[model samples]
Target: MKSRKTRVLAVLLVLSLLGAACSKSSDTKEKKKTEDTDYEKHSMETKESTEETTTETTEPSQRDTSVRPVSTPTPTPEPIPMLTAADIQSMNNNNALIVYNEVGNVSTIVGRFFHRPVADEDDAINAIKGVQELLGLQTGYFPFAVYGERFQGYTVYTYQQMKEDVTVTNATLKIVLDQEGYPCMLQSSLASNLDYTPSSPTITEKDAEEIVLNNMGSGYRVLSEYTMTTVYTDYAKAQHCYQVYTNSLIDNASFDMPYIVHFISLDGEYINAYPTAFLPTDPFADYGQDSYFKDMVPTDYSFTINVNGNQVDITIPISKNNVDGKYYLCDPDRKIIVADYYSFEFKGQLKFDTQDDPNSFDAAHMVNYYYYTQAYDFYKEFNIESTDGFGMPILILDGYCDESGRAIKNCCNMGIQYGWSVFAATDGYSFGHSLDLVGHEYTHGVTFYSKQGVQYYNEYGAINEAYSDIMGNIMEMYMGETSDTEWAIGERSGDECRSMSYPYKHYQPMYVGDLYYISTSPLSYLSGLDDKGGVHDNSSLLSHMCYYLYMNGMSLEDLTWFFLASIEMQTPNADYDDFYAIFVASARMTGHEEIIPLLSDYWESTGLKGPREQTAENTTLEGYERINIPFYSAKVGAYCVVEVYSVALGGRYLYTTMQWDGIATFLAPADGTWFLIGITEFSDASLSTKVSEKWLNHDLTAWTDDPNDLGYIVFESGKITTFPTYQ
Candidate 1:
């Protein structure tokens, strides 16, 4: 995640309308007008001179006027339009639905496709191809890679998509099957419009590398091993670009962001660059065959550590290499290893040396040992072994630093390079001390290995960040909360970085069009904008949605498993809509369909259905159901204060919220007469007051100091009639 520094955010005051791309050409009529005027002046002068010199006047020409017949031109015939997501949805059975990306490719398809069980890999591929043809997906979607796995009693087949021979970044087609291997649902992020004229790059691979290096400047070196030319879609247009992987030589200096990915067009034009670090931000080390785990002695190390100035004792399971007679900071049973800076640099055995020092690097390792184990145990309950589900060792680099020996304050999952590994650097205090942060980093690995995972940018990156934050908080809760409360991350570090329950407190968006919402509309995957297109900033919308689920009776465990299943159903280029579909599929798959209604309500409330608009409705609402009422104002920054007054409570205001977006959410407190009062800056505009169910029980002091004293006129004569009695 980006550095969680507190600051005020500029509101998205106005909505922008999107139109088709077009070009404008102006006719040069001004020059012609000047020439014509000059000629007219000369002609008039010559006429007068001729009249004075010759004294002869030519007879006025007789005017002739005749109506002419006009011919109509036939209009050109338009090209046959290919099937779109809407068209495909209309043609398919109601049970199966497909969602297309901005580029018109089927990003996700969730539901049963085949009438019967798929036979094998060949059957799955053929079934997908036939579906593509039936849906009129004109692009070529050949399977470049295919694999099968089992989870939650379901057998799943995953196919990576490619165009011609070039790889499509983060594109995949997943075929899920029930226990008997029958096809259940399909998901994809394949490219479309493959008929574009192809041309070879003017710049060679070496030239592309040099261009990227020059653009990246000094103190940065490209990791040539990870560089590859792939097809990336931007603004619905696909182009071949080189994905250059580079990192900063200095860590945490804020000059060159680490794990920077530069997308250079194949023709060598620089497109965009940004850090893919999992905190604000890999293959395999098979140590199982080594003597370390084979001949290791298991032990439990106990230590007293300071957490928010309070001493707490904890125990973590670890192992000692009997062959080397050194204790390693690892739990062999859980397949986790905590490597120190020295061990990572020298590639030596990560030996645990000390246990009593509270401020030493060993203490940091112990902290990671405890939390990583907790996060592992949390996932293990869902039958997931590790990040890869293959018992791969979860490597945690404790006391990690740059080559210059400067301790970085940040901790990022280095899984992009080293599979299933997290490298953290500490300055004054250790990030290992924060459970949510550690779990946040750990979940990054989980997202990396998720079935369709996702690329780390734009809306996809925001979802990635939200997964870590949500699961991190869940993991913190699973391990038993200490200094920090639920739904808030980073409170243990003295600064409440983000609040899942109230995202607005941190200037993060709670809905799609909320204050900090970032637009990925054109679908530029490599946009190097702020916070990676607000990946960390807009992530709260999803996290708060999960929080809403938790508040509306979804158990944490149920939410956890459901989210894990949803991630399995996701695509690499998924946005909010794609996620909504995936989430619905997961709800049914996890046997929690009861939550779908509330989830849908949350979706609409969060603006996933589109921007909030005014609608006609009864003044009164039933029970705890929330309603959005839009109020009109002639100016921006207009205030609409909504209050709930209970006669049972001495006719006093029970709750109030100052809404600026015009939409107000209301909930009835009890059974009796409740007055809904609306105080608005615009008295002429028809408006209604509301106290959103979300803000009903929470403290309203943050919204305003006694909204009744704001001295604003009541909406439509102030007093909305009695609300229907709700149990």
Candidate 2:
């Protein structure tokens, strides 16, 4: 019955691909933003590279005359450019998939194209460059770095540019491949004419600082809390300007708090560089002198001294940074404060006051040790310095829930990349104090912030949660003392570890294909069932596999397998299929091909076979009602774009259209929630792409007769979804 079901779905997948190919291809605006500037913020997309456009499904027999499995995963893939005359005919109808209104200074190609899966990514890239050549555009003009790809049928590649060690905004490229792995449809943007002569800064750093201080409103006017200044060029409103980076004490409780970036125009006007987002980490922080010293990791100052009439040695931790001569990194966003349930009236953190409660000292001491040490371990091991790889501080809100900023006895005992910081709860010193737990929580931040983290939330989100758990298990195995050695996550908080070796022992699924296996709508899982749709519950499957590999034979190279996988595949909305392929690909790249057999054994044991060939239009799917979102903004024009995506993993691209008077209606592919992405200019990487790819391609200030030379109109939707804004 399963094979029959597979066959039926496979046939439908092929038909949908064919019908999509046959239709005149309308394209998505190419908006590639790189990860360089993105900190531990809202991670990347469900934008799987080269997503095959889903067409209205046809009856099984009435579709393609040829009947073949659309997405088949054999031990050895047949690398064929499966193109027919029909495919070419479809390609002609959808030649230019990208829609440019000749307004924004970006270029992209998005639509259907013929392709064959190449054995290596380098080959696939070359195939894409071939397409660019055919389009009569200079290959160098479209600056992008391919961040993701699907190796199976209909490979899609997502690319963003990171030039000069900074993220480019307003430029992106997405190339779609046919069943044979050839470029068919492409959606991308490249800056056509840019001014990159490093225009002399008309303002000084002091002047910029004064501008920032003057413009900062009440509740933010305390001048002493601001420290650490950095100067860089910022391009957000489609213009180049200088920017200042600093940490401001958001709350008076402590000094040296969260990070913020203030922009200054050459004319000394203060610019809110990132109006709708958190400021990125230091632009110059990617490289630094390496020191293999433990001191490199922040540690609590310990001392034996007579204070309050007693000689005692005390070492404690709470959010503190040089408060009365002790160090603690507190929340910079000032969102986390003392919780209500905790015993003490937690006004400020546990300062270096001997009168402070002993329990307070212990909680602070232990949690900080775990948080800081594990953070150091990530840098020493995988070269990720901070959560977002830009030295963003690990914001540990002890005895407080990150979301609520109040102390609930056992509130939110996990690690999260909240507002570009690792917001962790002290949880009255339970899992919050455990080394493995801290590692587990912090690892979640790393995974969410990693380049591969673009696919951070749904199935990949489950993978995100699982990666943290696995790391916790791995850390305990490699670094834990004999008494503490155990392969479980939230061990201290739950009083037992979720068994990695025998997950079912903990009432968790040990295999992927279990009756309880979850693959869609992560929110439903979180909202409906336990363990948030098996994020922690189902992680046991992957964790068990990791433990088996460790018990058998695993090395740093083996452990770093996931790290490499994440950096390369940042598909924001990834799923089981995307994960398996990426895992296998990472294994192959890291010379751990010997582990492939184990992967097949373990993954197949759970019933997960890469990505299933199914359409978003599957009526058989539960809650499968289709809805249309009418997007009408009075302020949108040729320069504007409207994109709607499934809010789950694989970030299913639902629809992309242009609005004249800000009204672009989208016929959603499937049910559940959809994210509406409206772009005047898009993505984090496109900013740099504009300067480097277009403006600096030849140091030319201007180009003529560009299609992207258009303008915008105000857009509004009845749904009121979150989107990037141009203020």
Best by TM-score: 1
lDDT agreement with native, every candidate: 0.53, 0.37
TM-scores of the candidates are 0.66, 0.43
Which parts of model 2 are misplaced by more than 4 Å? Answer: 1-128, 131-365, 402-406, 409-420, 452-457, 482-486, 492-494, 513-515, 522-532, 561-568, 610-727
Per-residue lDDT of 370-465 in model 1, one digit per residue for the tens?
877887787766655666554555666666566566666666676523333444545345556677877788787776665433466666678788
Quote the lDDT for 491 in model 1: 73
Consecutive 10-residue window with the lowest summed lDDT within model 2: 1-10
Candidate 1 TM-score versus the reference: 0.66
Tens digit per residue, CA lDDT, model 2, 344-387: 11232222222233234444434444445554454435444455
